[model samples]
Target: MDVRTDEIAEQIYRVSVFVPHAGGGAGFTFNHFLIAGDEPLLFHCGLRKMFPIVSGAIRAIMPTDRIRWLSFGHFEADECGSMNDWLAAAPHAEIMHGVMGCRISIADMADRAPRSLANGEVVDIGGKRIRYIDTPHVPHGWDAGVIYEEVTKTLFCGDLFARLGDGPALTESDIVEPAMIAEDFFNLTSLGPTTAPNIRGLAALKPKTLAIMHGSSFSGDAEGAIHSLADHFEARLRMALR
Candidate 1:
């Protein structure tokens, strides 16, 4: 596994760890997005075992201890597995997540108390304004949610548009098709009634950049890409019903 970091948006860095031959194809990437601001926020904790390398990657941009806010899309291992590890390193860092996540898991799982954000709650982290949206089971996880960086118009959507391979850190190409292909292979998303609607709600944000957790981060027509993904899942739901 090799970890590489790239700035996908203004002061927003995508730290990716690519593992070859792991996703039943070329490989997969466990990506973590670090938002550099007055109160720096690090999204996605990677895995507990990958702490050293992931932390090292983060250290390249800012000191590990300077991170002030920690959050992720869900409570998965790849998302917040290294929760305690980060708290141990960044003494001032506080774990933030959706209300249900904190009530169900984070409040107990985390080494320290967590701040639970209500739906559509926005937290000003210095130069960046992060809005947390509750999206339960859109991709997966009952406590699933996502954060939107207002200044950058970047949506830190976890596991949505997830695909296999070591694509560039950021691309302007079509991500919806590749994501659908990966969906056919992995079937990782929890397709249900709210799946398409939840994604469509995100499209309404009209994001210019999509900070994806796997594969590549997209920087072009983000709204269209998100809507297309919703359409695909809606079609799947129709097929499943038939």
Candidate 2:
């Protein structure tokens, strides 16, 4: 599957879409968010090659040098491998991650001390605000967390309600039935201890749209849909432990 990027918003942001061809047509999608601001923020930097993809997306949205924050969910390659590369590209962009991501990154990139983000901590992006919501075990990565923008009603969901598929749809209005999308979303839910509580933190924020790294994003009703996902995780967690 070819990775594609598009500017969907009213020129406020751009999404760098990555389609995983390894899924045998059951491909999955991932994204990195780009916007111009007093300091730009780039979410979910993809593979090594994706660095250029991210740069191009930013250039399309704002300018090649507009980024100021390069954030990721955890230390996963599908999400963060290009971070080091991003650091090199964007001189002013800071690498944002949780505790472990910082520790691991600091080991190699000692000069670049990442700003450790905790749940509910807000990072200023010019006039916009990006708050971190920690998700410990949605699929079992310790440093996993998500970023939410209150004013814009956007959630840079790490991997909370993910589905392994691909399409041109980028927002909620693009979907036919959102509930059906939720069902398929469960397909990506990792089987283990339930991670509902972690997801709940992000749910509480009432995000209008969720830019999930995999599958299509959740558009309208994002608040209720996210809570439902949180509920699903909690129930599964309870079931697993019992």
Candidate 3:
């Protein structure tokens, strides 16, 4: 349970905890992103059981109580597992998620009302502006979505390009190979028709940095990597369907 923090982008910190022999394999990393702004935002709360560790990492950068928004791509243990805990810690913190997620889970699950963002909707938290994109079933969850920071060109892509084991905190090298391997192990991507198209949409953003939920954050040709992932999913889906 060794948690550490790294500044992956300007004013954006990655708080990661690595567990060796995770599930008896190569090990895994549970990561969270903190955007330090006037209204600080935290993406992915980590598992509820690891709330103390996650909060501690955040506190290192800024006061845990200063967080104004707690957001996640979808409702999952690694995403919003500690929503209530965050809200309780930060008295004014508001939950932010896709419209569907709000209607499906956040509305009832969160301690306070959540602010639902429709696809393409943007919100400004101090200096950074985040835009929400609805990507249903692209990487599994029907309520899945991602946030893009307009200024930094950073995509808070949850579970997309996820890799197994303890990868580097940030890499400019190829992540596709490892991500494909992890995808094969988890079989997490949906074969839905919208999968490729959704991936392409994110690619269109040409993100300079990918603030991934698991493993390392990519800082290279994110558009190219995304397109590669789209092609990989399309081919895999075609093969499975056949």
Best by lDDT: 1
For each candidate, what TM-score against the reference?
A: 0.98, 0.82, 0.98
- The predicted structure with the larger lDDT, 1 or 2, is 1
Q: Write the per-residue lDDT of candidate 2 for residues 1-242, one digit (tens) a residue.
A: 35466654433454646465644555666677664457777777777766676667566557655678888787778787777777777777678777765775534553367888866788778867888776665554766677777667778777665655666546665332343364454555554544555556565677667776666666788767766766665666677678
Q: Could you tell me the lDDT of residue 217 within candidate 1?
A: 96
Instruction: Give the per-residue lDDT of model 1 (tens digit) for 96-126.
Output: 9999999999999999999999999999999
**lDDT of model 1 at position 221:** 93
Candidate 3 lDDT by residue in tens digits, 1-242: 77879999999999999888783487888889998878999999878999998998888888899999989888999888888999999999998898999999999989899998989999999999989999998688889999998989999989998888887789998888889998878877877778888998898898999998878999999999999988988888788789
Ranking by TM-score: 1, 3, 2
Q: Estimate the lDDT of model 3.
A: 0.89
Model 2 spans > 4 angstroms off: 8-12, 18-20, 104-111, 173-194, 238-242
lDDT of 1: 0.94
Which runs in model 3 stand beyond 4 Å of their true positions?
none
The C-alpha lDDT values of all candidates are 0.94, 0.65, 0.89
Count residue pairs with overlapping backbones in model 2.
2
